[model samples]
Target: MKKLQFLSSLGFFLFGFLLFSNLKAQNSTSSSLYFPPLGEETWEKMPVNQTGWNQGKLGEFLAWMENTNTRALLILKDGKIVVEEYRGNRLTGLGPMNEGSIWYWASAGKTLTATLMGMAEEEKLLKRKDRTEKYLGKGWTSMSPKQEKAIRLIHHLTMTTGLNDQGVDLDDTDPSSLTFLAKPGTRWSYHNASYTLLKNVLESASGQSFETYFKEKIGDPIGMGGFWQRTGKNHVFYSNARSMARFGLLLLAQGQWDGNQIVTSDYIREMTSSSQGLNPSYGFLTWLNGKSSFKLPAIQREFEGPIVPSAPKDMYQAMGRNGQFLMVIPSENLVIVRMGAHSDTSLIPYRLIRDMWDRFAPVIE
Candidate 1:
């Protein structure tokens, strides 16, 4: 009887030890990612040979970027910089573009706004299902009160507000510029006006100016040196290339920076995953690569297959009007940022992403 009792105790101890070991392993793996210090120019880097990438193809890949008008390109592996390069003129009389030069994110800033919305939701300051009129008040849009009531805050995030997008400048946010089209959530259009109104929604819900809230909640904490600029009627975000990479790293880490959960992981999952069925390739203001079909800006029909065929199925992007791209691939533990002048006239530039991956895959894979 004594022997049996001793054996049982030993068994329990062994089981507990194994469990503890497993948990520790997981924590170590998750914590392996490095984050650059806040308010500093220093960032850790991983050696190219250690990344196991084909070094021979790297030069050609970078040459492709320069030839394609890429001003800045950064690639991070496990939160460590693998490759960082800046080329081309600044065009702002600020000399040649470099690591410290500022560039417009254009529509890529939509992802930043979406993350802010998620943070606000986690704090109970706002809910995705809340009506836009709740924050913007009545008569904010030209639609009738009853019609506008059907449009929820989620509709704006998903770009399904059914606002009229038939014009040269779909980003105009004025009440007169916003006119009713189809019923809310019944159509999927990349209407910028609906997205731009989200700024007001965030402001009204948070009881703080958009700039102040963003800086406090995201920018300062992550060491992002950027600011929102008012260009005509639109509010655009501008930041240096490394600042953009830092945001991508935050996304790659599932909204966590170092040990702090800046934005809840739950909301990050929802924001990156497919939000609506009409366009499976679009998340909440973010573009997804792997989906059955995708819809483009100003286009009525859906295109078959993934938006970027060469990109990993799990990869999602924060793309802008010009060649700006913030791509996050969780499976590969990679975050790539590209900021440049217009590579093409297309709004989302799905083809540009696809072609870039075509040149990049040989080097990385």
Candidate 2:
């Protein structure tokens, strides 16, 4: 009977040990985020069943995306591809749009530029408080020396340069094109000329071409494939849908890639959060959702409530003209990328976010 009692206690001890080990493994798996291998086409996919999403609803959501002129759509959950589909043809009529096809990021590339600026700041290459004239030199804008000196890198990033955003080609970077409207920090407008000139700021401070600096600092590091294409005076970024998803993943990780701090966490926080009081929804070249109020691009009037009502309160986005979008929702460990032709002609298609979240919220919830 003593021998029997000893064997029973030993069995209970073994069972408890095994149970504890299993629980620890589960917790580790749940806490860790996946990172895809660099320079390879390999990306892990999380099965729909494993994601706890309604499969039927997801199908409907994808169908809705295709019907709305979507060429490529990628959704990542915890750094794993959950929904990836390439539908329709290229907007340029070059060929069918696929995973490898390149598309213009339009204004969505602004977020990328913003990331580079943050990285530059972290490297002691530039300071946000530095005047724009210091990089572009005096008479870069039509504004007087005093007015021009008042404009800072932060003002350009936040779109509060006080430059005349009306009655001129917003993309024109010529000194004559950039006329002063208000004192710096007094007004907020989506002045593309001011934003585009950041290319010069980046180039001047880093002592490297924008493309070279971008590839060395960001693109190559994160395994992203893209190049800055000159479209008239504007330099737009073009890349495959996967490249866009990779960027969103970097933002989701708060500028970390595979245990490397590519961009400082402090800069990332500032880039994603509200940059100024003028527009609560606008970040540093990024658009934030869930703000109390938001002002649309080129419009002075402010609207009530969050930009995307159906999305998570913590969601922010890199939105572009037409339908290009890179949305990051940290709260859900989710990153979504959509690239395609014009869904609408508005300078920034705010409605697409609303429609996407409306269909997307149901499946995830």
Candidate 3:
């Protein structure tokens, strides 16, 4: 009787150990994100069933995007393409919006400038604390020398330069257009003219055209191909959707590509997290999703709650006019990119993203 009891006790212990080990393996596999090889078209895929994603629901969501003028929507889970949809045409002309078609990133390109500024700082080409006048010269603005000097390069990155956005030339890069409204760091206003001046600041500091500096520092190294176009006083970035995805992936990996550290980890934290107090939902030209409150473009009013409630609390995004978006969710190991014609104003894309999350939540853990 004693021998039989010992055999049964050993059997129970073995079963419990195997069950715990299997559960651990599944959690580890599901929770981690993947990184693909640079310069390769190949990427791995996580099967829908394995991901706990409902196939029928995903089909319904794609169908809804088709009716909403969505040109292209790509969602990456663990660095692999899980949902890819392309529709509509290029906005400037009638052409199929495929993987090869390039589209403007509009204001979303601000984050690119922010990244370049960080990289330049990493290389000791410029410092964020330096005054704008240091690069653009003493008389570069209409403000008194003292007031102008108060506006530093970091102010440009944080949207706290206190430059007037009510001027006739919002996109103007001319010194006169950069009129003073409030003292630097006293207010938070999304002034395009103030942001566009970073082009000149970077050029003067680095002694390189924006294109050359970007190509050598980021584009060529990561296999991303995009060009900046002069539109009025603003330089807008244009690239295919995949190129945008590659940039998002770079950020998702904390500015690292494969094993190479493209940008310092400290800069990545500063750029993606909050850079100022006035608008808690903004980083260094990047829009943070989860915060206690947020300010919007062309408006001084502050709203309560995260920018996008449905998105993960840690998500940070680059959004543009006409609905271009590159969203990175670190907690979920997810990167989402959307490029299309304008749909709504007043940043209602927050609602759009909320709906997207509602559909994706059931699929993801």
Candidate 4:
């Protein structure tokens, strides 16, 4: 009798211990994603040593950034700022370019639109699979009705609209500029015209301006301060460095801000994960890392291997012209934002973040 009792006790104890360990891990993961309170400048901070980042190496990284005309670089780990560096203002056109200065997000704003589109989907304003003409009318594109019908809303989000990018003004909104390249979903091109058309589709579908909808859906909920300003043929978002980090945090949490789920987790997953087959290294307007292959802007070549090998495999980003970058790594509970003038000839921000990770891994290890 005592032996049986002992066996039963051992089984119960093992189950209890396993359950406790599981719960602890869950809590730890949750705790790693920090959400700052709304309407406040206050945000939690984690010490540099806690991240296992060597201070000496970190200083070297900052020196490199300063040498390269980096305006601001902020790194968030477990939802708190671990490293924040600000340098000279080489680009006077974009505000003061200081800590509180507002700078344009450029193409990085596309990620914001993607998030808004997901919210619109949640609200039943529109569907990703819905035909573009469903919202923009049949004649919105110069393509024939048959070709237009095949081009769904998702093509815009995925940059697979089969739109001709040859000799087309990227920011031009005229219907004639949207020339046909191939059938929808057959070809993938980083055509800004297709992406810009999304703004018109969102406005038409939601019965609100893109800015209004974004302010209501994402900006208000997350305590983010930014506005869409008319810049040539595009609407550019300008905000301080902290606001960009806030948005990155929201993405890192999979569209959850604090306790409120701003965008559905499912939509967030689809937005961050691969959206189409053409480019496995891209999500809904976001750049993904650790993919088997990737395609660059204005290039049809598919390079084999992760985009940024030095960064975390799970890292994805919103990159913009002039080196605006917002990198979100879910596995590490990290959100990194860089806003500044372009330091290199290439538009890709991979080198910047790769250099960051190379120096950062030692500290956090």
Candidate 5:
């Protein structure tokens, strides 16, 4: 908690202020404002009583996971439920959480987009090696003439898309931004804009909207029935806690369902494991905890920005605003999902993922 309070003290404004500054000038320039839709769904509250999942000190911490809003946590290890819990104002502090409770995926949905991309590859719809210009020609052209050249889908997937945060870095055309932070296969950055654009490329190549394609390829198979937010909505999906777990199970099982393979296990490994080495803390669109190619020194800078050493070293997560998270730890054979408003004050779901991992790790082994 000392470390967390310290992290809370870090400069979150620099990240927010920097991001907000760029949003204005780029507003008209963007294709749409629907990137992450905020439409409210009448949340379906399940009975909060979970038999196997009431963890120890972790339970008290989990009660905080949903601190002021709806929340649920599920743990599966060695194919058994270790912990499951949900608390929301809707529950009125009674009843128990069940298998059905829809929660927003937020940016965590980006992993689904990338998963669809891998499935498309298996079907040969598009190739990662294809130049970004080939599929997103008109849009990529409009992005910038400089960005049009030599940018590949693989580069976009790994977040080395020759672009920088328009909000933080005023100069998108700056020399360093123009150049890949590291070569295509060497680095990683959390580029929301670039990853969202991949949605278009997939649609263009597959003749299917992003959500429909995912349902056809993945949801139906895993029995998750997860539904996507409309086009331009980058990270909004609704599904039960079990649905979230199924997605995690698909990943935990390395992209298979019902003894049938949906995505190539080889590709799943690439997506979950480090695809690029620049930031050892990040995977394709997911977050990870691991060694870095170079010391990022977040603690040295006392940085609490997105990339830092506050999470599990072996953990990879699909995280979003308002405390929506799906954390998968392969070594523990674990899948943990936490969804809710952790705090109105904290923006990154810092405590949900960061603190939960620390508490969960000890009991896991």
Candidate 6:
């Protein structure tokens, strides 16, 4: 009799647990916000912050780090700035930052280059299908037998020129800059030398320097103020949080500005889509945050997260050296930009997203 009673009690508890799980799944299924597909429209009204929402740990993070040296955090939904905060010291703490402060994009600038390549193609200045040597010519052809075959623009953009890590130490003009370590597009490696070579390719093909082409075309039209400034002898670019936000906005809009269609629709489609076989999650000059499962190189392991798995399967990102990140989630109609000389320089955005997403993602009607 006692065994029968025990079985009955156990059955009741199991039933309740299953019932609760079903209810939770139903709530999650009913959630309107989901992972975004490439080029899917997600433009939403600005200021996702609502009267009542759970910011969770994010509120505590901001409250504690008020005086820190983080540069700027700008969050926009449907093109209106929702969260704009500046902390820490500036260049001598002189001018206040608006949308005018220019931050060196580092490798994040690669996306700009990729987008320009697409624009140039649309204007007939360059063609993706054209062999790289069509312009670079015989001088560059003296590379290794394998290198000669591998010298395409696609190889440069994909970081698969098989150029070894030589440029990590080599100055731009070193003889090794022209060397190739593997056949083109067959390997997955990070080669700044291969990418730097692209500046030359664009110059030769477009008949304009990278700086000039972009300024005359995309930068000026978008109303973004930027300059490749010579800070001392080193040339770098700077723009404020708003400029970065606009850049993200252009991306999330799929290369359209005010319905003007800045970058061709086909190029935007390809930009967010993976090109090389090595990483299905990575696209041309862009890093994908979610997709079918794959292992990242050990260095990239730290930057990825279950965030991709749980957030959106179709999400992609543009990340820069030292953790500069531009995340465009079309499902959320969100373009988030974090620009900073992060205090530790580890490159993690840390609590900014932790707080913002938790606070703003509730989707209260």
What's the TM-score of every candidate structure?
Answer: 0.92, 0.91, 0.87, 0.89, 0.70, 0.73
Q: Which regions in candidate 1 have their CA more than 4 angstroms from the true location? A: 1-29
lDDT of 4 by residue, 1-365 (tens): 99999999999999999989965764456555788889898988998878776788777777767766678889998889888777765345644456677778989999999999888988888999899999988888788889878999988999998988888886787888887889888888988778888998999999999889989998889999989987898878999889999999888776677767788767877888987878899999999999999998889999998888877888899998878899888777888888887666465656766766777666555
How would you order the candidates by lDDT, starting with the best? 2, 1, 4, 3, 5, 6
Model 4: runs farther than 4 Å from truth?
A: 1-28, 90-96
Best by TM-score: 1
lDDT string, candidate 2, 326-349, tens digits: 999987889899988764878799
Candidate 3 residue lDDT tens string, 3-95: 999999999998999988865653443335566666766667776666567788777777777776778888887778887778877756777
For candidate 1, write residues 1-365 as lDDT tens digits: 99999999999999999989965753464487899998789999999999999998887888777777888899999999999998877849568888899999989999999999999998999999999999999998888888888999999999999988886368788888888889988899998888888899999998999999999999999999989988877789999999999999888877889988798766888999999999998999999988999999989899999988877899999998777899999878899999987648677877788889998888877
Q: What are the lDDT scores of the predictions, listed in order?
A: 0.89, 0.89, 0.82, 0.84, 0.62, 0.61
Task: Write down the RMSD of all candidates, one decimal each.
Answer: 5.1, 9.5, 9.2, 5.3, 16.5, 11.9
Per-residue lDDT of 322 in model 5: 76
For candidate 3, what is the TM-score?
0.87
Q: Which prediction has more favorable TM-score, 2 or 6?
A: 2
Q: Could you give candidate 6's per-residue lDDT for residues 1-365 as a string of tens digits? A: 99999999999999999988965653342232222222322334344355232455446545543544457777665565556777654545667654456566656667777888888888888776666777666556337554575467777667666655543442242344566556777777655545555666788888988789878777776766566554432334566666666778777766767656678656876888877766666678777655554334324233334335434545567665454667787765667776665444533343443444454344321
lDDT for 149 in candidate 2 is: 88
Error of 1 at 291 (Å): 1.0
TM-score of 4: 0.89
lDDT of 6: 0.61
| Alpha carbon lDDT at 316, candidate 2 | 92
Off by over 4 Å in 2: 1-31
Which of candidates 2 and 3 is the stronger one according to TM-score?
2
Ten residues in a row with the worst lDDT in model 4?
89-98
Which candidate, 1 or 4, would have the higher TM-score against the true structure? 1
